[model samples]
Target: MTGSELKKLLEDSPEECHKLLMKEYGRYVYAIVYNKLRCCGSREDVEECFSDIFAEIFIDFEYREAYKGDIKNYIGTVSKHKAIDFCRRLNTVKGRSVYTEEEDIRQLASDFNVDERVDSSELRRILLDKIDELGEPDSTILIQKFYYDMSSNEIAKNVSMTASSVRSRCSRAMEKLRVKLAAAGITR
Candidate 1:
């Protein structure tokens, strides 16, 4: 399906979205998950990561910005990141590896001036500032969803909205934040 169509499908209940995504991209998802897990996760871990992607896809479908590029690419990108995350967490649980994709993404997303070409630090700083500007309940929900790692359902329960509403609110809030950041000169 086209990105728009797939996005519409994703607006359905999570179970429906999961089934649709699995039927559409299960093989591609499995391959990316397998590759990412090869160095880190066992077969079971890989399978769990594969399953987890569906739930994540549902979240992205409901809350995050609309996918503007190839759907497969987006799925693969998310799956690869998720696999790395799962493996890292498993390793941590086993006391094997302390390094993780979350830390790597945080660093990459940080404001390091290592390269003039990719100083996302300024953007990060502005984004955080704008989020702080949002204030109170909205800020709390946004942080819980993004920083504190709460799910939409959990966020909805706390904020007293349906999961879908939580997703839409998060998207609009992010768009507002992005606009504020861009206005503050955070391009690309």
Candidate 2:
């Protein structure tokens, strides 16, 4: 369905609009969530995230519609934020140090900047290979989010979900990925 059609659906009955969203835009939403949270979760987790994304859209229908702009872009942006938030929450609950203070950032820069002459092409290839090991939807999502930098809201509207959902899923996905990367000895 076209954006205009989806917009009309949003204006119509809530049930109708939701159904349309599920039928039409589910893939885009799934892709976005998968991209963000795939590394940190199982297939079940990805599915749950996808469902939540849609549910958020349904619940906050009015709030979403109020934002003016390209629906696809909005959805992608929102989903990315939601995914990031999820990762932060998960890290907090797990008692993991996800984001360090500025001191840590400075330390990283100091330590890694010395090797600025190193080639990144190999690292990029390896990362892509690792991402390819994920399941169908998650793999697609990760590539889009990390490799392509597509926003969650943009992905959401493409898939028909709430922007918030996209953000949370992306967060969870990234967390999972960090764990995987660490396990693979790709630490910072």
Candidate 3:
């Protein structure tokens, strides 16, 4: 049915709208949710995400107001977002493989005797301290983005920022780290 028809049905009889919504979009929403969660979630997780997507469609104002286009687009958008949320929650709650790309910044070669050469361990400590100084979400964003190789969207979910904002923060954080590392005799 058209979004206008659905909106009218929602106003006149919400129960019927709910029924019709389930009848029409249930499988479509489930498919989107399933595609997102298939690798990390159980059957129960998929069902819960499916239910949440419909619940969000029912309450979210944007979904209700935007009847100018096909309602299928609205339903699909809602499904995609809800599934992403589920993916973040399920993947985070489970034990993830702690694989981090080694930070590849190389320390400047020292001219001193072998016995007095700069210790790699000390440089690593300085690097970690600099990252800690960047503070909460910035540090977290950097670790998620570079260390864990997460996309900006995935990192934004964890940090509670928009994807673009996350990307910008990541850029700023990297620049700051580059300067700090340079001061510490580490260069990219």
Poorly placed runs, candidate 3 (over 4 Å): 61-63, 97-188
Return the top candidate by lDDT: 3
TM-score per candidate, in order?
0.45, 0.47, 0.50
Model 2 over residues 1-188: C-alpha lDDT tens digits? 55566667677776787787775566567667776776676567667777777777667655655645446665666677777676666567778876589999998888874354454646665666666665544555666676556787776665466777767766766677777778777876
For model 3, residues 50-126, the per-residue Cα lDDT tens digits are 99888888876325476854788878888998899889888788856455444422222333346444566477558
Q: How well does candidate 1 match the true structure, expressed as C-alpha RMSD? A: 18.2
Error of 2 at 83 (Å): 1.2
In model 1, how many backbone clashes occur? 1
User: What is the per-residue lDDT of model 1 for residues 80-138, given as tens digits with 9 covering 90 to 100?
Assistant: 88888888898888889444688797887796557765556566556667887876556
lDDT against the true structure, each candidate: 0.75, 0.67, 0.79
Give the better candidate number (1 or 2) by TM-score.
2
Residue 85 CA error for candidate 3 (Å)?
1.5
Model 3 residue 140 lDDT score: 78
User: In candidate 2, residue 177 scores what lDDT?
Assistant: 70
Clashing pairs in 3: none
Once model 1 is optimally superposed onto the true structure by TM-score, how far is the C-alpha of residue 43 displaced, in angstroms? 2.1
Cα deviation of 65 in candidate 2 (Å)? 4.9
